[model samples]
Target: MTKLERSQIDFSTFMLYRLAEHWGKSVPDTYRILDKANAIDGYLVPCYDMLHTLGSEYLVNDLTDYVREQGICI
Candidate 1:
């Protein structure tokens, strides 16, 4: 990938980490949810589009709720 794409992936991963920490979840678990919700053709959605479409707060909240309801302790 290009440097810009790599940077965006890093930033997106960091955001996922923050979201996981905020919800007391493992990063992998959080990633699974994000992947399911936003992945396209085995890749994550672009960071800008993801943030614009779902917003960080809403995405975290929705994933938190879903994880809690599913009782996914990991």
Candidate 2:
């Protein structure tokens, strides 16, 4: 599929997969930290990790990089 078509899909797995593949990062086995939690909880997990452990700026960098590398249109 073309990049435009691929970007139209609503699959978090595929979006993250494309980013990780492009970046050559060791993408985790699972995207969600908590399988049972809601999106707010899941989003907060990463937010907390960045804020306390890696710093908030790193989180912004990560998000920016992910978007740039993934070509995630949504």
Candidate 3:
């Protein structure tokens, strides 16, 4: 998997949106959860470690699929 840059706000937001959709939670709530869990890095970047900590393998897989579909190179 490509490493997503911490500066990619649009990409990060899209991931958050997709995660929220998959988890059936509101976007803000999802952010809150990640924030509380310290899963988000500075600048709101989400990493593989975060996903693993959250036990969100399905979400990670979905994100990979989404990135592939979008042709995003990290």
Candidate 4:
């Protein structure tokens, strides 16, 4: 894959695992939650340019808020 593509994947992976840990859920479960809320594609990936610059805690919190706002209990 191209470097940019790889970077995006890496960042996504990092956020996935980080979120999983933050939410006390498995990676797959966390992924499901985000996916169900459309946070993964709709927000996370699309906002990666700005999201990646934030801290891990902020990212997790932001994601949590995003998911919650989507009306999914995560």
Could you tell me every candidate's TM-score relative to the true structure? 0.54, 0.28, 0.47, 0.92
Residues 19-69, candidate 4: write the lDDT tens digits.
999999999999999889988789877887888899999888988998999
- lDDT at residue 17 of model 4 (Cα atoms): 98
> Model 1's lDDT to the true fold?
0.61
- By how many angstroms RMSD does model 4 differ from the true structure? 0.9
Q: After aligning candidate 1 to the native by TM-score, how far in Å is the CA of 34 from where it should be?
A: 0.5
Q: Which digits, one per residue and each the tens of the lDDT, describe model 2 over residues 1-74?
A: 86633433333344345434544554462233212223223343334433335443554445544444545332
Q: What C-alpha lDDT, on a 0 to 100 scale, does residue 4 get in candidate 4?
A: 70
lDDT of 3: 0.55
Model 1 ranges with Cα > 4 A deviation: 39-74
**TM-score, ranked from best to worst:** 4, 1, 3, 2
Clashing pairs in 1: none
Could you tell me the C-alpha RMSD of candidate 3 in Å?
11.9
Please report the TM-score between candidate 2 and the true structure.
0.28
lDDT of each: 0.61, 0.41, 0.55, 0.88
lDDT of 3 at 42: 41
Superposed by TM-score, candidate 3 places the C-alpha of residue 54 at a distance from the truth, in angstroms, of 18
Please tell me which predicted candidate would have the highest lDDT against the true structure: 4
Q: Write the per-residue lDDT of candidate 1 for residues 26-61, one digit (tens) a residue.
A: 988878866665532233334444553556677666
